[model samples]
Target: MNPVVEQMNRRRSVRNFSGKPVDEVHLGRILLAAQQAPTSINGQQISLVVTRNKETIARIAEIAGGQPQVAGAEVFVTVVIDYHRTREALKSVGAEQVIAQSAEGLMVGATDAGIMLNALQTAAESFGYGTTAIGGIRNDPQAMIELLGLPAETFPLVGTTIGVADDASLAQVKPRVPLATFAHMERYDAEAVRRGVAEYDRQLRLWWDEQGLTQMPSYSESTAQYYSRVYFPKVAESLESQGFEFRDD
Candidate 1:
């Protein structure tokens, strides 16, 4: 088996870290890894702002609803979905007029930003460093944009904090559903999907209970509750307030 494959299988989110710092050499390699990720249309719209400043880290932790692990990480990197670079690239090549008139370019920028983040996470894990992705950073987009000096149309999507893990900070790998549940044959099988979820829900509830967490409701119920209780409304408001016009044809 390939070393990278093994690493991929073992990857888990780490929200705790040691006092030790990540060396600059490894940090540069991680940036390189992000740059190497495949981008939509080669748009390469991701931008990263690295911060080692304690004050800035503190602010990010606060903005992320006070995730203490974030404040103590050795380095923080804010990943942004950026349109400024794309806009400038188009202008330099005399394509600005056409590109600016279409939202296609903007969509590509956002997709590439997501690709870059996954690359960064993989790179950090491969190098034996711990990382925690801070999605709540999006909750205070306006403040983060100002703090990071982001130009209009450029926005912080999320951030990742990285450091070596302390002995006591090691985390267990959480179990996911068996491949048979999601890896299906050629055509979609609705019944199989439904049955799979039933089995997985049992597995999940058992795991959660063992970990001293509350039992899950039925899979569909839990799925609906997650979005209704935590996701969609906030996301919709964020996009609208950030000036992203929703267009339905």
Candidate 2:
């Protein structure tokens, strides 16, 4: 395998850190790597707020359900999807057609944020640093926005934490679903994909068993029921309360 591909495969999210402060020069490089990530139509709507202050970090971690990973991070970076830029651009150019100022526009910002985050993760791993992405930052949107002092038309898309590795605990790679399960050729192949997923589930279960993780759960069964019970309603209510309007595409 190519070295870069190997590096990527070996990358894992680190929840524990050594609490070593990253110097401004290295932090600048990581930020620059993120800035260079690809964006939709060259319209980059991702905004990042870097927090090194103990108070802000504490507040963000509190809003993230008191995840120790967030508070323990040497640096906490909140990545937001910004819609105001698109609105300003549309008005500036006098475009008659405007994208809906809701989830549709928000998707663009989130996509940009995701791409940039992946780049930062890759760069950090290459530099021998440990990093973790915190999607839980979206759990309480209003609190996060208020704590970060975010402006209107902006939503917390995700967050990232960085610090020095303690002892390479996160050096191993997590298994992924088989390509046949998600990757398609010229057209969709549902049956083939289903079979691939079954194989993947078996592999995952075996891996879990070997790792002595608690009783292995069916991948599809848990995933299908997870949203209805845990994520969707909370996320929906939070977004609605924060004045985010979503329109059908």
Candidate 3:
């Protein structure tokens, strides 16, 4: 197998860190990789706030719903979908209409942030560091904005924790749904989606059992439960408070 492909295949979310500091040189390279990720129309609306401060990390861990890795990792990079810079740039060029209040602008900023974060993750992994993306950063977007002193037209998108993986962090690769499940040809196929998810649920249950885990639920059930019970209940209000408007016009 190609080395890159092998590396990707072996990638897993590492929640336990060995407490070793990431090298400064490696950190610089990882930041450069993140900057090299493509942006929409070269807008470059993504910004990263790198933190190694113990107290701040601890506070962030608390904000992240008590995820220890957020505080224990060697470094934490908070990815921000930032339109403040672009809006200023537009003003600099004498463009009066600079506010990014549209859905397209929000999506572009978020997509750019995601791309940069993925690049950062890949770079960290290439340097033999373990990383996990933390969506819990959005658990309290308002608090994050205040704590980080983020300006207007900016919002926390996600976070990445990087560190040397502890021995216990080396777990088996988690299974994903079959490619045909989401990768459509020309038209959407409902039957294929159902079949693929059913098969994937069975495979996931088996994988969970092999790992000495019980009480595994089907993918559809788990997904529905999570969205209906956990995520959706809070996300909309948070996003709206952060100045995101999901306008259909």
Candidate 4:
């Protein structure tokens, strides 16, 4: 496998850090990778804020449902979907700004944010840094906006913590569903998914059993444990609170 793809394929959540700050020079390279990521319509509707402020990191951790990885992180990068710059440019030129009010617009920003995050993680890992994406940030979008001082047309997309990995926190990579389950060859493969579901559950249980975690639940059960309950209600409120309009029904 190619080195780049290998770096990307090693997807594990690093929840422990060494409490050491990252080198600004290396961080600059990661940020560059993020900036170079492709965005929809060349709009570049994204911005990232990097900080080492202990207090801010702690607050973000609290806001993210007490994620210790965030609380202990030496570097935290806040990625947001920012239409503010484009809005200002449009206003200055007396052009109508409407994309910020629809489902497609949000999709563009979120997709760009995701791409940028992948680039960030790959680049950071290349420098021997550990990283984890915090989806819990969506639980309190209002707090994120106020804490980050994000302007209208700017909304939190995701967060990342980068630091030296603690040896103990380095766990084995978790298994994922088979490639044929998701990556169809030029078409959707419903049958592949039907077959892969139980296979992945078994694979997950075997992995857990190897770790002496016999009581651990299967993939579908674990997934349902989270998905069965409604989560991130704040995310919906964010559409209105953050100056976004959602029209898709």
What ranges in model 2 sit over 4 Å off?
Answer: 88-103, 215-218, 221-225, 230-234, 237-243
User: Candidate 2's error at 1, in angstroms?
Assistant: 4.3
N/CA/C clash count, model 4: 0
Q: Write the per-residue lDDT of candidate 1 for residues 185-207, one digit (tens) a residue.
A: 78777787778887877887777
In TM-score terms, candidate 3 sits at: 0.93
How well does candidate 3 match the true structure, expressed as C-alpha RMSD?
A: 1.8
Segments of candidate 3 deviating more than 4 angstroms? 230-242
TM per candidate: 0.86, 0.86, 0.93, 0.95
User: Which of the numbered candidates is closest to the native, going by highest lDDT?
Assistant: 4
lDDT of every predicted structure (CA atoms): 0.76, 0.76, 0.85, 0.89
lDDT comparing candidate 4 with the true structure: 0.89
CA displacement after TM-score superposition, residue 168 of candidate 2 (Å): 5.4
Ranking by lDDT: 4, 3, 2, 1
What's the TM for model 2?
Answer: 0.86
User: How much is the lDDT of residue 34 in candidate 4?
Assistant: 75
TM-score leader: 4
Backbone steric clashes in candidate 1, count:
0
Per-residue lDDT of model 2, residues 1-249, tens digit only: 898998887887788787787777888898888788888888777778999998888888888888988888888888877665666887788874344345676577667888878888787777777889988877787788778777766778788888886674554455778886688888999998889878877877777776677475757765777765667236666555545667855
